[model samples]
Target: MLRRTGIPLLALAVFAGPALAGCGGGEPEESAADLLSRAKTTLDDASSAHFVLDSEGAPNSGTLLVGGEGDIARPASFEGTLNVRALGSTLDLEVVSVDGTVYAQLPFASGFSVVDPAQFGFGDPGALLDPDTGISQLLAEAENAELGEERRVDGDVVREVTAELPGDLVEQILASQDPSQAVQARFSIATETGELRRAELTGPFFTAEDDATYTVELSDFGADVEITAPPTG
Candidate 1:
């Protein structure tokens, strides 16, 4: 009776060993370059997305853009509010961009008026989602990309990537005083969807003497968003 029981148990153990090994063997993790490529493709394919921009360690003086939150639609359309720091005061301005025209309702103003985006120390927000000159471009041009540990962001599993971006490339999206200094960029991309969740940049954006940090959070991809030029009357 003992011999018979021992033989059956040994056979069962041999069969279970292979099955257990197979369970642990899934697809290999993606390389940092490949992951960034996928993320860039995902952003380029998105029709519309919501974004929030924030900055830290900015100089106390001078006219600077500090924060902004808005929705951007493809083919150049954006509706959002920008926080500008001028003369030690933070001014919130409502802005709209459509058809290559930018309009803003300045403080103490009755209505929107045509304005140049650079006057506020920033570039056109509407072009942020443009495939050629937008955040996707940064991902495509990242150098020495390296994947970091995964973390949970806003309830989504995301993998972090560390890389360096050319200051000239960054200047196309935001204002930069020195385009010769390289910017350190950290990107958090969603593992499941390949969508870019957050981007942190550190460089000499406002002045060459000091390095400031800017953080951008992106979400709400493919949302039903309609952006039209505001009446300037």
Candidate 2:
């Protein structure tokens, strides 16, 4: 079983005030919005990063192993396991989204298949952090943004921020609500490096469930990221 995400998944403390600079960076004081915008720019310009998305106990779940690790990159594709809790089974699923198309190795299959990620509860995981309409856009459109206190996350001290996300992005990425429904979002960034560490969205995504939290953690920024369709026999 995958390890739990730990206690850092607290609801980001949202204070009603101007943003503040992160905990340690010896830089000009910046509001939560400024910091987020800067970080978004940094990530948008990067080629790739090792990513791990954990949504167990969430409305949707899944994955794969690279040397026994679940590592995926952005801008085009993701390879990992797809967790099916209802059936208590997991499938090796790889997804690629580029040029308005999605390719994948569906569960219980070996060859690459053209598929839609929306069927898996995500419109497109590859674009979840898109420079334009993904997290970058959300941060740019964030409102009531506030910087929270610094805290340790997975052993590293990170600066936290909480804000309200645009309704459209919430519907697109989390999809826990109707397009018109609004939601809150929180993010943590490395104080020293301004790197985004974690993102949490709290809202309703599943049927009959009032509200659920989906957390996505990112690491290994700027690692080699290469994606290609599976080989045809």
Candidate 3:
């Protein structure tokens, strides 16, 4: 009788183990809004970061930004190269911004020259990390945000959040041809660190007739970076 009772108890324990594991014994999953809030805070607290911006389907004839990669420091400072489509060709311009003034080494130019950022169809890349006017604003203003799949990015687990953004707000961060049209955005935030890993935007950014997609990747948060104005001749 003792042996028979022990067998039954062992069977019960084996069955219960799988049930407990299936019930998700870990912490509860975070809501989409809560995750975005945490990501915003993470970026807001970061002093500097590295970024890569790439766009697709942009018109070839206009003075529009095609791609860029560089480092940005807090309180408005940036150093990087920008790919701009102008005069029917793409020009890679070396740019540096400090305190609202933009300096660029124009193609075939001898030295850096002060120029208007708007001429290239985008504003100060340095402002991309601003807590109030930059990426944080998009997180706070996202409408109907919904959590999507989780995936590994650069060896880190990230969660995707899908949402719609106001076109005017997007226009402020990047350039847009139609500020009245809404833009779709997908944000990938690191699950462990709550840091924004990537942002994908799709909308009529270059022209009202065609839609363009821009992918921005952020990393190296809180990096010790210092940017200064280039010597202009």
lDDT against the true structure, per candidate, is 0.92, 0.63, 0.92
> What ordering of candidates by TM-score runs from best to worst?
1, 3, 2
**Candidate 2 regions with alpha-carbon error over 4 angstroms:** 1-28, 56-75, 84-92
TM-score of each: 0.92, 0.73, 0.91
Which residue pairs collide, candidate 2?
19-32, 62-83, 63-80, 63-81, 63-82, 64-80, 64-81, 176-204, 176-205
In the range 138-207, model 3's lDDT, one tens digit per residue, is 8989999999999999999999999999999999999788999999999999999999999999999999
Compute the lDDT of residue 221 as modeled in candidate 2: 75
lDDT of 2 by residue, 1-233 (tens): 23354333332333322233344456576789878988788778766665555553443232111111234456655554443233334444666555456666765676777776666556665565567756567667778999998998777888889998766667765565554556677899887677788877666655424555666677777787676655643
Which regions in candidate 3 have their CA more than 4 angstroms from the true location? 1-25
lDDT of 1 at 174: 84
Distance from true position, residue 44, model 2, in Å? 0.8
Which structure among the candidates has the greatest lDDT?
Answer: 1
Q: After superposition, how far is residue 183 of candidate 3 from its true place, in Å?
A: 0.5
